[model samples]
Target: MATDVTVPTDLWEGDLEAVITNWLASDGQAVKQGALLAEIMVEKSQFEVTAPADGTLTITQAADAIVRKGDTIGRIG
Candidate 1:
Protein backbone atom coordinates (compact mmCIF):
# COMPACT_ATOMS: atom_id res chain seq x y z
CA MET A 1 0.00 0.00 0.00
CA ALA A 2 0.98 3.64 -0.46
CA THR A 3 0.96 6.61 1.92
CA ASP A 4 -0.55 10.02 1.40
CA VAL A 5 1.28 13.28 2.03
CA THR A 6 -1.45 15.02 3.92
CA VAL A 7 -0.81 18.59 4.89
CA PRO A 8 0.68 18.92 8.34
CA THR A 9 -1.83 19.99 10.96
CA ASP A 10 0.51 22.64 12.23
CA LEU A 11 1.26 23.87 8.73
CA TRP A 12 -2.31 24.92 8.05
CA GLU A 13 -3.69 25.20 11.55
CA GLY A 14 -6.89 23.40 10.60
CA ASP A 15 -6.99 24.88 7.15
CA LEU A 16 -7.13 22.27 4.39
CA GLU A 17 -5.80 24.40 1.56
CA ALA A 18 -2.25 24.55 0.33
CA VAL A 19 -0.20 25.29 -2.74
CA ILE A 20 2.74 23.23 -3.88
CA THR A 21 5.80 25.28 -4.56
CA ASN A 22 8.31 22.65 -5.65
CA TRP A 23 9.24 19.03 -5.44
CA LEU A 24 12.72 18.31 -4.15
CA ALA A 25 12.47 14.83 -5.62
CA SER A 26 11.00 13.74 -8.91
CA ASP A 27 8.01 11.49 -9.25
CA GLY A 28 8.66 7.82 -8.50
CA GLN A 29 11.99 8.71 -6.99
CA ALA A 30 13.39 6.72 -4.10
CA VAL A 31 13.59 8.59 -0.81
CA LYS A 32 14.85 7.93 2.68
CA GLN A 33 12.90 8.62 5.82
CA GLY A 34 13.03 12.29 6.83
CA ALA A 35 14.38 13.32 3.42
CA LEU A 36 12.94 16.50 1.97
CA LEU A 37 10.47 15.45 -0.65
CA ALA A 38 8.72 18.68 -1.54
CA GLU A 39 8.19 22.30 -0.58
CA ILE A 40 4.62 23.36 0.11
CA MET A 41 3.08 26.75 0.56
CA VAL A 42 0.23 27.20 2.92
CA GLU A 43 -1.32 30.26 4.51
CA LYS A 44 1.04 32.47 2.57
CA SER A 45 4.17 30.68 3.79
CA GLN A 46 6.39 27.88 2.56
CA PHE A 47 7.40 24.70 4.32
CA GLU A 48 9.20 21.47 3.54
CA VAL A 49 7.46 18.15 3.82
CA THR A 50 9.77 15.27 4.63
CA ALA A 51 9.24 11.61 3.95
CA PRO A 52 7.89 9.57 6.82
CA ALA A 53 9.52 6.38 5.66
CA ASP A 54 11.92 5.01 3.08
CA GLY A 55 10.23 4.09 -0.18
CA THR A 56 9.63 5.04 -3.78
CA LEU A 57 7.76 8.38 -3.97
CA THR A 58 5.05 8.94 -6.51
CA ILE A 59 3.90 12.49 -6.88
CA THR A 60 0.18 13.02 -7.19
CA GLN A 61 0.39 16.81 -7.40
CA ALA A 62 2.46 19.00 -9.69
CA ALA A 63 4.34 22.11 -8.69
CA ASP A 64 2.33 25.33 -8.33
CA ALA A 65 -0.76 23.21 -7.96
CA ILE A 66 -3.28 23.80 -5.21
CA VAL A 67 -4.10 20.96 -2.85
CA ARG A 68 -6.27 20.48 0.18
CA LYS A 69 -4.78 19.70 3.55
CA GLY A 70 -5.90 16.09 3.36
CA ASP A 71 -5.33 15.80 -0.37
CA THR A 72 -3.04 13.14 -1.70
CA ILE A 73 0.04 15.06 -2.71
CA GLY A 74 1.99 11.84 -3.28
CA ARG A 75 2.58 8.36 -2.01
CA ILE A 76 5.43 6.15 -0.77
CA GLY A 77 5.52 2.40 -1.07
Candidate 2:
Protein backbone atom coordinates (compact mmCIF):
# COMPACT_ATOMS: atom_id res chain seq x y z
CA MET A 1 0.00 0.00 0.00
CA ALA A 2 1.06 3.55 -0.65
CA THR A 3 1.17 6.27 1.95
CA ASP A 4 -0.09 9.68 0.96
CA VAL A 5 2.31 12.57 1.45
CA THR A 6 0.05 15.41 2.51
CA VAL A 7 0.88 18.93 3.52
CA PRO A 8 0.33 19.42 7.25
CA THR A 9 -2.84 21.32 7.99
CA ASP A 10 -1.20 23.05 10.94
CA LEU A 11 1.97 24.00 9.14
CA TRP A 12 0.83 27.56 8.99
CA GLU A 13 -1.86 29.73 10.47
CA GLY A 14 -3.17 31.54 7.40
CA ASP A 15 -5.31 30.46 4.46
CA LEU A 16 -2.66 31.32 1.86
CA GLU A 17 -1.65 28.39 -0.26
CA ALA A 18 1.89 27.08 -0.47
CA VAL A 19 4.27 26.45 -3.34
CA ILE A 20 6.45 23.37 -3.65
CA THR A 21 9.91 24.86 -3.64
CA ASN A 22 11.93 21.70 -4.14
CA TRP A 23 11.79 17.94 -4.03
CA LEU A 24 14.68 16.51 -2.03
CA ALA A 25 13.97 12.95 -3.01
CA SER A 26 13.48 11.89 -6.62
CA ASP A 27 10.62 9.82 -7.85
CA GLY A 28 11.03 6.08 -7.28
CA GLN A 29 13.84 6.69 -4.83
CA ALA A 30 13.88 4.69 -1.65
CA VAL A 31 13.37 6.69 1.50
CA LYS A 32 12.99 6.12 5.19
CA GLN A 33 10.19 7.22 7.44
CA GLY A 34 10.61 10.79 8.70
CA ALA A 35 13.11 11.65 5.98
CA LEU A 36 12.87 15.09 4.51
CA LEU A 37 11.16 14.79 1.15
CA ALA A 38 10.38 18.28 -0.04
CA GLU A 39 10.37 21.97 0.72
CA ILE A 40 7.35 24.23 0.61
CA MET A 41 6.95 27.97 0.84
CA VAL A 42 3.98 29.98 2.03
CA GLU A 43 4.27 33.71 1.65
CA LYS A 44 7.81 34.30 2.96
CA SER A 45 8.06 31.28 5.25
CA GLN A 46 9.42 27.88 4.26
CA PHE A 47 8.69 24.42 5.61
CA GLU A 48 9.91 20.88 5.12
CA VAL A 49 7.76 17.94 4.14
CA THR A 50 8.78 14.55 5.48
CA ALA A 51 8.17 10.98 4.42
CA PRO A 52 5.22 9.27 6.06
CA ALA A 53 6.73 5.80 5.80
CA ASP A 54 9.70 3.90 4.47
CA GLY A 55 9.18 3.26 0.77
CA THR A 56 9.86 4.41 -2.76
CA LEU A 57 8.74 7.94 -3.41
CA THR A 58 6.27 8.88 -6.13
CA ILE A 59 5.84 12.54 -6.78
CA THR A 60 2.35 13.67 -7.79
CA GLN A 61 3.06 17.39 -7.71
CA ALA A 62 6.17 19.01 -9.11
CA ALA A 63 8.24 21.87 -7.89
CA ASP A 64 6.65 25.31 -8.24
CA ALA A 65 3.20 23.76 -8.02
CA ILE A 66 0.71 25.49 -5.82
CA VAL A 67 -0.72 23.50 -2.94
CA ARG A 68 -2.87 23.96 0.10
CA LYS A 69 -2.80 22.52 3.58
CA GLY A 70 -3.78 18.85 3.62
CA ASP A 71 -3.14 18.52 -0.13
CA THR A 72 -1.54 15.29 -1.21
CA ILE A 73 1.72 16.05 -2.96
CA GLY A 74 3.14 12.59 -3.32
CA ARG A 75 3.02 8.96 -2.25
CA ILE A 76 5.25 6.23 -0.94
CA GLY A 77 4.87 2.55 -1.65
Candidate 3:
Protein backbone atom coordinates (compact mmCIF):
# COMPACT_ATOMS: atom_id res chain seq x y z
CA MET A 1 0.00 0.00 0.00
CA ALA A 2 1.07 3.55 -0.66
CA THR A 3 1.17 6.27 1.96
CA ASP A 4 -0.10 9.71 1.02
CA VAL A 5 2.09 12.78 1.29
CA THR A 6 -0.12 15.74 2.06
CA VAL A 7 0.59 19.33 2.86
CA PRO A 8 0.82 19.94 6.60
CA THR A 9 -2.03 22.16 7.77
CA ASP A 10 -0.35 23.44 10.92
CA LEU A 11 3.01 24.36 9.37
CA TRP A 12 2.05 27.93 8.64
CA GLU A 13 -0.42 30.59 9.65
CA GLY A 14 -3.54 31.73 7.82
CA ASP A 15 -5.23 29.94 4.92
CA LEU A 16 -2.63 30.55 2.25
CA GLU A 17 -1.82 28.05 -0.43
CA ALA A 18 1.76 27.00 -1.14
CA VAL A 19 3.67 26.65 -4.39
CA ILE A 20 5.79 23.55 -4.86
CA THR A 21 9.28 24.88 -5.35
CA ASN A 22 10.97 21.64 -6.35
CA TRP A 23 11.20 17.96 -5.68
CA LEU A 24 14.28 16.70 -3.92
CA ALA A 25 13.74 13.12 -4.97
CA SER A 26 12.93 11.89 -8.46
CA ASP A 27 9.88 9.89 -9.37
CA GLY A 28 10.26 6.17 -8.69
CA GLN A 29 13.27 6.87 -6.53
CA ALA A 30 13.64 5.11 -3.22
CA VAL A 31 13.27 7.36 -0.20
CA LYS A 32 13.62 6.65 3.47
CA GLN A 33 11.20 7.73 6.12
CA GLY A 34 11.67 11.38 7.14
CA ALA A 35 13.81 12.11 4.08
CA LEU A 36 13.33 15.54 2.53
CA LEU A 37 11.10 15.14 -0.49
CA ALA A 38 10.13 18.57 -1.63
CA GLU A 39 10.10 22.27 -0.92
CA ILE A 40 7.05 24.55 -0.75
CA MET A 41 6.80 28.30 -0.65
CA VAL A 42 4.05 30.52 0.76
CA GLU A 43 4.79 34.22 0.51
CA LYS A 44 8.37 34.49 1.77
CA SER A 45 8.33 31.43 3.97
CA GLN A 46 9.49 28.05 2.76
CA PHE A 47 8.81 24.60 4.15
CA GLU A 48 10.26 21.17 3.55
CA VAL A 49 8.06 18.18 2.90
CA THR A 50 9.39 14.82 4.03
CA ALA A 51 8.68 11.25 3.13
CA PRO A 52 6.24 9.52 5.44
CA ALA A 53 7.70 6.03 4.99
CA ASP A 54 10.46 4.08 3.34
CA GLY A 55 9.38 3.47 -0.24
CA THR A 56 9.49 4.63 -3.84
CA LEU A 57 8.36 8.21 -4.42
CA THR A 58 5.46 8.91 -6.75
CA ILE A 59 4.79 12.57 -7.19
CA THR A 60 1.19 13.54 -7.88
CA GLN A 61 1.86 17.28 -8.03
CA ALA A 62 4.66 18.63 -10.18
CA ALA A 63 6.99 21.47 -9.43
CA ASP A 64 5.46 24.97 -9.46
CA ALA A 65 2.04 23.54 -8.71
CA ILE A 66 -0.12 25.32 -6.18
CA VAL A 67 -1.29 23.24 -3.25
CA ARG A 68 -3.32 23.78 -0.13
CA LYS A 69 -3.32 22.12 3.25
CA GLY A 70 -4.50 18.51 3.26
CA ASP A 71 -3.86 18.17 -0.47
CA THR A 72 -2.11 14.97 -1.48
CA ILE A 73 1.08 15.97 -3.23
CA GLY A 74 2.61 12.54 -3.61
CA ARG A 75 2.71 8.96 -2.40
CA ILE A 76 5.23 6.56 -0.95
CA GLY A 77 4.71 3.13 -2.32
Candidate 4:
Protein backbone atom coordinates (compact mmCIF):
# COMPACT_ATOMS: atom_id res chain seq x y z
CA MET A 1 0.00 0.00 0.00
CA ALA A 2 1.02 3.58 -0.66
CA THR A 3 0.64 6.61 1.56
CA ASP A 4 -0.04 9.98 0.06
CA VAL A 5 2.27 12.82 1.03
CA THR A 6 0.14 15.88 1.20
CA VAL A 7 0.52 19.51 2.15
CA PRO A 8 -1.29 19.94 5.42
CA THR A 9 -4.45 21.94 5.20
CA ASP A 10 -3.58 23.78 8.38
CA LEU A 11 -0.01 24.56 7.39
CA TRP A 12 -0.94 28.11 6.68
CA GLU A 13 -3.89 30.34 7.19
CA GLY A 14 -5.03 31.87 3.93
CA ASP A 15 -6.02 31.11 0.40
CA LEU A 16 -2.62 32.00 -1.05
CA GLU A 17 -0.99 29.06 -2.80
CA ALA A 18 2.50 27.81 -2.23
CA VAL A 19 5.33 26.78 -4.53
CA ILE A 20 7.50 23.73 -4.06
CA THR A 21 10.96 25.16 -3.57
CA ASN A 22 13.06 22.04 -3.27
CA TRP A 23 12.95 18.28 -2.97
CA LEU A 24 15.15 16.96 -0.17
CA ALA A 25 14.47 13.34 -1.14
CA SER A 26 14.95 12.18 -4.69
CA ASP A 27 12.40 10.11 -6.49
CA GLY A 28 12.58 6.38 -5.64
CA GLN A 29 14.71 7.08 -2.59
CA ALA A 30 13.95 5.16 0.56
CA VAL A 31 12.85 7.38 3.43
CA LYS A 32 11.94 6.90 7.04
CA GLN A 33 8.71 8.12 8.48
CA GLY A 34 8.80 11.81 9.52
CA ALA A 35 11.89 12.52 7.42
CA LEU A 36 12.06 15.82 5.66
CA LEU A 37 11.01 15.32 2.07
CA ALA A 38 10.57 18.74 0.53
CA GLU A 39 10.36 22.48 1.07
CA ILE A 40 7.62 24.82 0.06
CA MET A 41 7.42 28.60 0.04
CA VAL A 42 4.45 30.75 0.74
CA GLU A 43 5.50 34.31 0.08
CA LYS A 44 8.68 34.68 2.11
CA SER A 45 7.89 31.93 4.57
CA GLN A 46 9.19 28.41 4.02
CA PHE A 47 7.78 25.15 5.27
CA GLU A 48 9.07 21.59 5.35
CA VAL A 49 7.12 18.63 4.09
CA THR A 50 7.80 15.37 5.86
CA ALA A 51 7.44 11.75 4.88
CA PRO A 52 4.22 10.25 6.16
CA ALA A 53 5.51 6.69 6.18
CA ASP A 54 8.62 4.60 5.63
CA GLY A 55 8.90 3.72 1.94
CA THR A 56 10.30 4.65 -1.44
CA LEU A 57 9.39 8.14 -2.47
CA THR A 58 7.55 8.86 -5.71
CA ILE A 59 7.23 12.53 -6.51
CA THR A 60 3.92 13.47 -8.03
CA GLN A 61 4.63 17.20 -8.10
CA ALA A 62 7.95 18.54 -9.27
CA ALA A 63 9.98 21.38 -7.85
CA ASP A 64 8.67 24.85 -8.60
CA ALA A 65 5.13 23.55 -8.95
CA ILE A 66 2.43 25.62 -7.33
CA VAL A 67 0.35 23.73 -4.84
CA ARG A 68 -2.53 24.44 -2.57
CA LYS A 69 -3.16 23.16 0.91
CA GLY A 70 -4.06 19.46 1.07
CA ASP A 71 -2.50 18.78 -2.34
CA THR A 72 -0.84 15.42 -2.72
CA ILE A 73 2.72 16.06 -3.75
CA GLY A 74 4.10 12.56 -3.52
CA ARG A 75 3.47 9.00 -2.47
CA ILE A 76 5.33 6.49 -0.34
CA GLY A 77 5.07 2.78 -0.99
Candidate 5:
Protein backbone atom coordinates (compact mmCIF):
# COMPACT_ATOMS: atom_id res chain seq x y z
CA MET A 1 0.00 0.00 0.00
CA ALA A 2 1.01 3.60 -0.56
CA THR A 3 0.37 6.62 1.60
CA ASP A 4 0.37 10.17 0.45
CA VAL A 5 2.64 12.59 2.31
CA THR A 6 0.88 15.91 2.57
CA VAL A 7 1.78 19.41 3.69
CA PRO A 8 -0.14 20.02 6.85
CA THR A 9 -2.85 22.64 6.68
CA ASP A 10 -2.12 23.81 10.20
CA LEU A 11 1.57 24.51 9.70
CA TRP A 12 0.92 28.21 9.86
CA GLU A 13 -1.72 30.87 9.67
CA GLY A 14 -3.35 32.13 6.47
CA ASP A 15 -3.54 30.48 3.03
CA LEU A 16 0.01 31.35 2.13
CA GLU A 17 1.94 29.23 -0.32
CA ALA A 18 5.29 27.75 0.64
CA VAL A 19 8.46 26.80 -1.18
CA ILE A 20 9.97 23.36 -0.83
CA THR A 21 13.42 24.35 0.39
CA ASN A 22 14.96 20.90 0.57
CA TRP A 23 14.30 17.22 0.84
CA LEU A 24 15.91 15.39 3.74
CA ALA A 25 15.53 12.02 2.11
CA SER A 26 15.97 11.22 -1.56
CA ASP A 27 13.40 9.44 -3.67
CA GLY A 28 13.14 5.69 -3.05
CA GLN A 29 14.71 6.10 0.37
CA ALA A 30 13.23 4.12 3.22
CA VAL A 31 11.61 6.32 5.85
CA LYS A 32 9.93 5.87 9.16
CA GLN A 33 6.73 7.50 10.26
CA GLY A 34 7.42 10.96 11.73
CA ALA A 35 10.91 11.19 10.21
CA LEU A 36 11.81 14.54 8.70
CA LEU A 37 11.33 14.45 4.97
CA ALA A 38 11.39 17.94 3.65
CA GLU A 39 11.62 21.61 4.52
CA ILE A 40 9.16 24.29 3.44
CA MET A 41 9.52 28.04 3.64
CA VAL A 42 6.87 30.72 3.73
CA GLU A 43 8.43 34.16 3.49
CA LYS A 44 11.13 34.04 6.19
CA SER A 45 9.64 31.23 8.21
CA GLN A 46 10.39 27.58 7.56
CA PHE A 47 8.79 24.33 8.57
CA GLU A 48 9.60 20.67 8.25
CA VAL A 49 7.36 17.99 6.79
CA THR A 50 7.59 14.47 8.09
CA ALA A 51 6.87 11.03 6.75
CA PRO A 52 3.29 9.90 7.21
CA ALA A 53 4.10 6.21 7.33
CA ASP A 54 6.98 3.74 7.29
CA GLY A 55 7.79 3.03 3.66
CA THR A 56 9.88 3.95 0.65
CA LEU A 57 9.52 7.61 -0.30
CA THR A 58 8.70 8.70 -3.83
CA ILE A 59 8.92 12.44 -4.28
CA THR A 60 6.21 14.00 -6.40
CA GLN A 61 7.21 17.60 -5.75
CA ALA A 62 10.86 18.47 -5.88
CA ALA A 63 12.87 21.10 -4.07
CA ASP A 64 12.18 24.79 -4.86
CA ALA A 65 8.61 24.00 -5.93
CA ILE A 66 5.79 26.11 -4.61
CA VAL A 67 3.11 24.24 -2.73
CA ARG A 68 -0.04 24.89 -0.78
CA LYS A 69 -1.58 23.50 2.32
CA GLY A 70 -2.77 19.90 2.11
CA ASP A 71 -0.81 19.36 -1.09
CA THR A 72 0.57 15.88 -1.63
CA ILE A 73 4.35 16.27 -1.97
CA GLY A 74 5.16 12.59 -2.08
CA ARG A 75 4.05 9.05 -1.49
CA ILE A 76 5.31 6.19 0.67
CA GLY A 77 4.96 2.58 -0.27
Candidate 6:
Protein backbone atom coordinates (compact mmCIF):
# COMPACT_ATOMS: atom_id res chain seq x y z
CA MET A 1 0.00 0.00 0.00
CA ALA A 2 1.02 3.59 -0.60
CA THR A 3 0.66 6.53 1.66
CA ASP A 4 0.02 9.97 0.23
CA VAL A 5 2.03 12.84 1.63
CA THR A 6 0.13 16.08 1.53
CA VAL A 7 1.19 19.52 2.64
CA PRO A 8 0.01 20.43 6.09
CA THR A 9 -3.02 22.68 6.06
CA ASP A 10 -1.77 24.58 9.09
CA LEU A 11 1.59 25.24 7.53
CA TRP A 12 1.02 28.92 6.92
CA GLU A 13 -1.23 31.49 5.36
CA GLY A 14 -0.35 33.85 2.53
CA ASP A 15 -1.60 35.26 -0.71
CA LEU A 16 0.57 32.93 -2.74
CA GLU A 17 1.28 29.27 -2.53
CA ALA A 18 4.43 27.69 -1.15
CA VAL A 19 7.33 26.68 -3.35
CA ILE A 20 9.64 23.80 -2.83
CA THR A 21 13.04 25.23 -2.12
CA ASN A 22 15.07 22.14 -1.52
CA TRP A 23 14.74 18.39 -1.61
CA LEU A 24 16.61 16.61 1.16
CA ALA A 25 15.92 13.22 -0.33
CA SER A 26 15.65 11.86 -3.86
CA ASP A 27 12.79 10.01 -5.51
CA GLY A 28 12.61 6.30 -4.83
CA GLN A 29 14.86 6.78 -1.83
CA ALA A 30 14.18 5.18 1.49
CA VAL A 31 13.18 7.70 4.11
CA LYS A 32 12.51 7.21 7.75
CA GLN A 33 9.65 8.75 9.62
CA GLY A 34 10.37 12.19 11.00
CA ALA A 35 13.31 12.64 8.61
CA LEU A 36 13.61 15.85 6.71
CA LEU A 37 12.34 15.28 3.18
CA ALA A 38 12.08 18.72 1.70
CA GLU A 39 12.09 22.43 2.44
CA ILE A 40 9.27 24.82 1.54
CA MET A 41 9.44 28.56 1.16
CA VAL A 42 6.49 30.72 1.97
CA GLU A 43 6.32 34.38 2.89
CA LYS A 44 10.09 34.57 2.57
CA SER A 45 10.66 31.94 5.21
CA GLN A 46 11.88 28.39 4.84
CA PHE A 47 10.35 25.41 6.57
CA GLU A 48 11.37 21.79 6.57
CA VAL A 49 8.87 19.02 5.82
CA THR A 50 9.42 15.59 7.27
CA ALA A 51 8.57 12.12 6.09
CA PRO A 52 5.27 11.00 7.53
CA ALA A 53 6.20 7.36 7.61
CA ASP A 54 9.13 5.02 7.07
CA GLY A 55 9.04 3.96 3.45
CA THR A 56 10.44 4.41 -0.04
CA LEU A 57 9.79 7.93 -1.18
CA THR A 58 8.03 8.44 -4.50
CA ILE A 59 7.89 12.06 -5.43
CA THR A 60 4.85 12.72 -7.56
CA GLN A 61 5.72 16.36 -7.69
CA ALA A 62 9.10 17.69 -8.73
CA ALA A 63 11.38 20.08 -6.92
CA ASP A 64 10.66 23.80 -7.16
CA ALA A 65 7.03 22.89 -7.64
CA ILE A 66 4.45 25.39 -6.55
CA VAL A 67 2.15 23.95 -3.90
CA ARG A 68 -0.58 24.85 -1.49
CA LYS A 69 -1.77 23.54 1.80
CA GLY A 70 -3.54 20.15 1.47
CA ASP A 71 -1.89 19.43 -1.88
CA THR A 72 -0.59 15.96 -2.42
CA ILE A 73 3.13 16.10 -3.07
CA GLY A 74 4.09 12.50 -3.13
CA ARG A 75 3.56 8.97 -1.94
CA ILE A 76 5.48 6.59 0.29
CA GLY A 77 5.41 2.83 0.21
Task: Give the whole-model CA lDDT for all candidates, comma-separated.
Answer: 0.82, 0.96, 0.95, 0.96, 0.97, 0.87
lDDT, candidate 5, 1-76, per-residue tens: 9999999999899999999999999999999999999999999899999998999999999999999999999999
Please list the residue runs of candidate 5 whose C-alpha ends up more than 4 Å from where it truly belongs after superposition. Answer: none
Candidate 1 per-residue C-alpha lDDT over 1-77 given as tens digits, one digit per residue, 9 for 90 to 100: 67776656666576557888999999878899899988888777888888977899988888999877667788899
Instruction: Please rank every candidate by lDDT, starting with the best.
Output: 5, 4, 2, 3, 6, 1
What lDDT score is found at residue 25 in candidate 1?
94
Name model 4 segments beyond 4 Å from true: none
Distance from true position, residue 47, model 4, in Å?
0.4
Candidate 4 per-residue C-alpha lDDT over 1-77 given as tens digits, one digit per residue, 9 for 90 to 100: 99999998888898889999999999999999999999999999999999999999999999999999999999999
Best by TM-score: 5
Off by over 4 Å in 1: 14-16
TM-score of 2: 0.97
For model 2, the superposed segments whose C-alpha errors exceed 4 Å read none
Q: How accurate is candidate 2 locally (lDDT)?
A: 0.96
- For each candidate, what TM-score against the reference? 0.84, 0.97, 0.97, 0.97, 0.98, 0.90
Q: Per-residue CA lDDT of candidate 3, range 1-77, in tens? A: 99999998989998998999989999999999999999999997999999999999999999999999989999999
Clashes of 6: 0
Better of 3 and 5 by TM-score: 5
Per-residue error for 34 in candidate 1, Å, reads 0.6
| Decoy 1 TM-score against native | 0.84
Model 5 / residue 46 / CA error / Å: 0.6
* Minimal lDDT window, size 10, model 5: 43-52
Steric clash pairs (candidate 3): none
Q: List the residue pairs that clash in candidate 5.
A: none
